[model samples]
Every structure is written in structure tokens, then in C-alpha cells.
Target: MQLIDSRYIMASPEVVWAALLNPEVLKDCVPGCESMTGSAEDGFEAVVAQKVGPVSARFTGLVKLSDLDIGKGLTISGEGKGGPAGYAKGGAKVTLEPIEGGTRLSYEVEANVGGKIAQLGSRIIDSFAKKMADTFFERFQTAVEGPAEAEEGTDETQKKGWFKRLIS
Candidate 1:
């Protein structure tokens, strides 16, 4: 499946980029993330638990970022194994463009799934995927956008993962 979407952040592009690469922020924003170990340099090993239709499973995966351009965005790719549930892998291209009030963050992801989950059909999988993406972006926007202003010049806008699409 392929998904593309965009959101406007209230913070500067630099702030958004930092949050995107931050494992802590990702762990909190990711839907089912349990733990993330590693950094942007070596990639992160993570565990995420999720439920799809009648299947619920814990997925272990590795996420890595490449082709990074500071204060912009990068390409993310990863794979996950969910035992009998299934396996998923995918890549995404994210870009940040400066807008009038903030940054326009856009992403395009293409993912492939196999095993029991894939057998459920694309319609089901696609619907679930879209929902997951919507939730993620909504939370991300809340985190980085802060309120109406940055108090004391501190942006507290509150903000997840590479294989997220794979699981959905």
C-alpha cells in the first residue's frame, strides 16, 4: 500500500526536524511502541504491540534513516516480524517546506505486508492504515504546534515510527 499526507507545524522547520529524529518523541507518539533502543546514527531497535481485526501481536523491528538533510527531512525504511501474525517492510520519503506560519511536512510511504495479515485483503488493510496515519499525524501536530504562542520563546508543542505503515 502507498500513502501520502501532509501537515502544518507551528514550530520552525529545525524544531520539527529535531523532533522527528528524536527517539523519545517517537516512542511517545507511536501508537503501540513499547520501547526504542538506539539513535539516528545506528538505527533503532523497537518493539510495538498492535491489533488488526482479529489479530493482536507484538512486532519487533529495526528502523533506520538515510539521505538526511538537516533542518529538512529524510527517508525512513524498516521491517518488522510479528511471529505468526505476519511480517511487514516499507520505505517513506518525508520533506519539510517552510510556509508562511510554519513548515509543511509531507510524506509518501509505500509498504508491503505478508502472511496472515496480508491474507485479510487490501481493503481492510488500507482502511486500518489510513486510520493509523491519521492518528499519528494528529498527535504529532499537537505536540509540535504548542498553543497559540511560544511562551518565553520556548515552544512546548507536544509529537512516531518508520515501520508504522507496515503494521497498519
Candidate 2:
């Protein structure tokens, strides 16, 4: 499947880029993430636990970051095995563009699933993926902008043209 989305973050590209590369931030923001241990240069081993439909499993996998352009974008690709449950593999291309208020973070994602998880059907998997994206970004935006700013300007952020045109 393929997915695309964009969100306006209330921070500089530099700050956002740093957050994207920070394993601590990623572990906190990403749903079902148990541990992401490694470096950007070498790659990371990730342990994630997630429930999709009727099955719940813990997946241990490797993630790699490449095709990097500093302060702009990068590619993230990984695959995980959930024992007999199934496996998932995907890659995302994320780009950051500076805007009037802050930065526009956009991503194009492609992913696939197999075995029992795939047996749950496409619609279920799609819904799960979208929810994960939204939740992840919500946490990430909150973390980058801080609780005070994130809470204070909800109405204003909605009014921004970039936001209005990008996601909805």
C-alpha cells in the first residue's frame, strides 16, 4: 500500500530533523515501539509490539536510514517478523520544507504485510496504519512544539493555509 501526508510543525527544520534522528524521541512517538537501539550511521534493531485485528505480537527487526540530505529528507526502510503471526516490510520517504510559521513535514510511504496478519484483510490493515501515522505525528508535534505552544495555538494552527491544504 501507498500513503502520503503532510503536517506543519511549529519548529525549525533543524529542530525537527534532530528530533527525527533521535532514537529516544522515535521510541516515544512511534506506537508499539518497545526499544530502538543503535546509531543512525550503523542502523538500529527495533522491538515492537502491536495488535492488529485478532492477533497481537512482538516483532524484532532492523531499520536502516539512507539517501539522506541533511535538514531536508531521508529514507527509512525495515522489516519485522512476528514469529508465526506474520511479517511486515515497508519504506518511507520523508521530506521537510521550511514555511512561514515553521516547517512542512511530508512523507510518502509504501508497505506490505504477509502471513496471518495479511489474512486480516487490507481494510483493517489500512485503518491500523493510518491510526499509527496520526498518533505518531500528534505525539511528535507535541514533543517538538512543547505542551505549552501545542495547546495554546490550536485554533491558529488550523487556520494556516499550509495545514488546511496539506492533510485534510
Query: What is the per-residue lDDT of model 2 for residues 47-162, given as tens digits with 9 covering 90 to 100?
Result: 99999999998999998999989999998888999999999888789999999878999988888889899999999998887787778887787767655423374654332222
Clashes of 1: 4
lDDT of 1: 0.78
- Return the TM-score for candidate 1, rounded to 2 decimals: 0.84
Candidate No. with top TM-score = 2
Maximum-lDDT candidate: 2
In candidate 2, stretches whose alpha carbon ends up further than 4 angstroms from where it belongs are 148-168
- RMSD (CA, Å), candidate 2 to true, equals 6.2
C-alpha lDDT of residue 80 in model 1: 89
Per-residue accuracy of model 1 over 10-69 as CA lDDT, tens digit each? 667877788778787777666898998899999988898888888788889998999899
